[model samples]
Target: MTIGEAYLRIAEDRFRRVKGLGDGTFRQLSERDFYERTSQHGNSIAIIVQHLSGNMVSRWTDVMTSDGEKSFRNRDQEFEPADLPMDLILEQWEKGWETLFNALRNLTEEDLLKTIYIRSEGHMVLEAIERQMAHYAYHVGQIVYLGKEIKGGRWESLSIPKGSSDQYAEEMKRIHGKNGG
Candidate 1:
């Protein structure tokens, strides 16, 4: 693959993994737990997801041609608590990801070098992608941490389980050998 294509491939994989972490974490929480904050001033998963969805839609739609911060986006309102159903929240989450993936899928190699605007600031397309990837990853980490805190002893490992480094290493070695051959 070309460098640009390789970057997109890696980016798409990371985005998929991040979404999987979120889906797994959310599955462990009760509907009411989605709105529960770790602290009085902290944001709930609901608010975080809302902000993510709003950001994804704003940044990805017409990504190459228009400003990433859409005129219709009410970014400030995303922080406020809402009583929306859990299903709606999840739907919005999926919708945002879909928008992002669609935009990424349509990007040509040349598009990576193109300038994009976010709130009147110009950024290379690659830089914009990295910026959103980092932003989403940060929030997804928060979601996973809160879910683990709430689940406590009942929490499951999203990656390699604790105290299993040897087993994981062996598995990776085996897989690597197969691919190498």
Candidate 2:
């Protein structure tokens, strides 16, 4: 297809991968694990979720016109631990992704060439998407790493298990070939 179409496809694919990693990790965690930090100053899963939700809401709400860093967002507060239930935190996580995905779905090819503001700095729409996508990927990596650490040997592999790369490659080839890829 067109360049914009390709860009959108790639962006959506990466976003889905990041979401899957975080969600899969979240499933492996217990309630206490959500609040457990790797260190005294490190972030817990709950805090990471809070920060992500806050960022998603701020950046995606009125994304086409308004500055991405919303005036009402208390970014600092996202780092502070709250006593909210795990379900509530996960609800917020879903809301954030909904907002972000909705915004992405609404984008037109031309919109990618247009400008948007984040923290008063102008960025092309595609650039803005790339920025946020990378940011979320980074945090998702953190969340997955923390989950793996906490679960230790019990953590279910999200992708190939530790020594299964050769088998995974063969399986991928078989599956893709069967689908005419």
Candidate 3:
């Protein structure tokens, strides 16, 4: 019911969105394919997962009490291409997010204003959560886009399909009704 709780909900929703992307489409690609760099500027899915895990672990552990960036976080290594297997990537993803959500689940509404540190700088608890949500969303967008490119026309739209905005709006209006506004 608090803003942090709302963030947890969004995290859960988007985490599922990230995982769902790999469900069917990933199986079509071999390790070599999954590891394949789709663009000169972008990392493969494996590296993105590594970064996500690193960020989650660093930012969530002892979040309200300690610097979010831990002493052991190897920040530089996150960007390096990793020969990580799909199973390992999936494991890290699961573990990282689990730790984050578990921590969030334990937070009280009063705790929202408590300060946390990241990179030795101060952040309000809600601010840090919002920051990471934005970061996760940025990467999820990349993942979806890259996944679609890799799958070509065989890929499904991760969101509303082309030219279907009106249909979606109409359905929402019918269900919720204009007077509900």
Candidate 4:
């Protein structure tokens, strides 16, 4: 594959991994868990989902032609308490990811080099993609952390269990011909 193709593949894989972490966390959470906050100053998973969905729709829609921070997006409102149903909250989360994936699907290698505007500042398409990836990963980490806190000892491991690194490595080596990381 070409460099651009490789980059896109890796980027997509990384984004999927991040999303999978959130997905796994969600499976272990109750509907009320979505609304729970670690502290009064912290955001709930619901609010994070809302913010992410709003950001994805705004940034990915008309990605190349329009500024990422769309005029229609209410950044402040996304942080407010989302008293919506679990289904609706999940729908918004899926919608955001779908928007992002759709936009990524439509991109070409050449487009990576082209400049895009985010809040009126110029960023190459590749830079913009990385920026969003980091941003989403940050929020997903919060979701996972909160989920773990809520579930405590009952929380299932999204990755290998804490004390199983050696076993995991052996398993990986067995599967990947002893060359696995």
Give me the candidate number with maximum TM-score.
4
TM-score quality measure for candidate 4: 0.98
Q: Write the per-residue lDDT of candidate 2 for residues 1-181, one digit (tens) a residue.
A: 8899888888888898899999999989898999999999999999999999999999999999899999999999999996899999999899999999999888888899999999999999999999999999999999999999999999999988889999988888898895659
Candidates in descending TM-score order? 4, 1, 2, 3
How far off is residue 147 in model 3, in Å? 1.0
lDDT of 4 by residue, 64-176 (tens): 99999999999999999998998999999999999999999889899999999999999999999999999999999999999999999999999999999999988888998
C-alpha lDDT of all candidate models, in order: 0.94, 0.93, 0.77, 0.94
**Candidate 1's error at 67, in angstroms?**
0.3
lDDT, model 2, position 172 = 82
**Which should have the higher lDDT, number 2 or number 4?**
4
Candidate 2 achieves a global lDDT of 0.93
Stretches off by above 4 angstroms in model 3 are 1-30, 178-181
Worst 10 residues of 4 by lDDT: 172-181
Pairwise TM-score winner, candidates 2 and 4: 4
lDDT of 1 by residue, 1-181 (tens): 8998998988999999999999999999999989999999999999999999999999999999999999999999999996899999999899999999999999988999899999999999999999999999999999999999989999999999999999988888798884655
lDDT of 1 at 134: 96
Model 3, 1-181: lDDT tens digits are: 8676776667567656655664544555566656778779779977887888898998889888889889989977988898677888878878888888788778766777878889888888778777887888787667667677777877767667889999988888899896656
